[model samples]
Target: MFSKIDLKSDRFVVVFINDILIYSLDEYEHAEHLRIMLQTLRDNKCEFWLREVGFLGHIVLTNGIQVDPSKIFAVVN
Candidate 1:
């Protein structure tokens, strides 16, 4: 599925299994990138979860990506 959509990694999009993360420097670019991804997913007949989505156990937010505390603890222990 990822092969079908052409995106610059860590710039526009990142994919892992069924999970997909769409990102951009600003709102306008983010919207555009999201639209492209949604369209691609729709065309591919793939559905995405609006909630409960995370990348490598980390949450991607406007401020920055955060590692899950539980995951960190597990690694530390």
Candidate 2:
């Protein structure tokens, strides 16, 4: 399923292990990406938690992706 998303996302989605990262340059584009991504997941009947999705030391949230602060702290110290 992750691979499917990666393949269909037109460079807007990435999957690493069990996590996914979807991104775009602006709010509207981001929404469209999210809509497409979520539709794919739902079509596949995937068990998903929007807030719990992330990858490569970042978290996907309602607003956008954010770097995990713990990772930042670990690198800074």
Best by TM-score: 1
Q: What is the TM-score of each candidate against the true structure?
A: 0.63, 0.54
Off by over 4 Å in 1: 6-11, 43-53, 73-77
Best by lDDT: 2
lDDT of candidate 2? 0.69
lDDT of 1 at 30: 66
lDDT of 2 by residue, 1-77 (tens): 66677687568876767656666777788788778888767546444435555467776676777898887996788
User: Which 10-residue window in model 2 sums to the lowest lDDT?
Assistant: 45-54
Clashing pairs in 1: none
What would the TM-score be for candidate 2 when compared with the true structure?
Answer: 0.54
- 1-77 per-residue lDDT for model 1 (tens digits): 56775455556777777766765677788668777777667646543433334579886655677887777896788
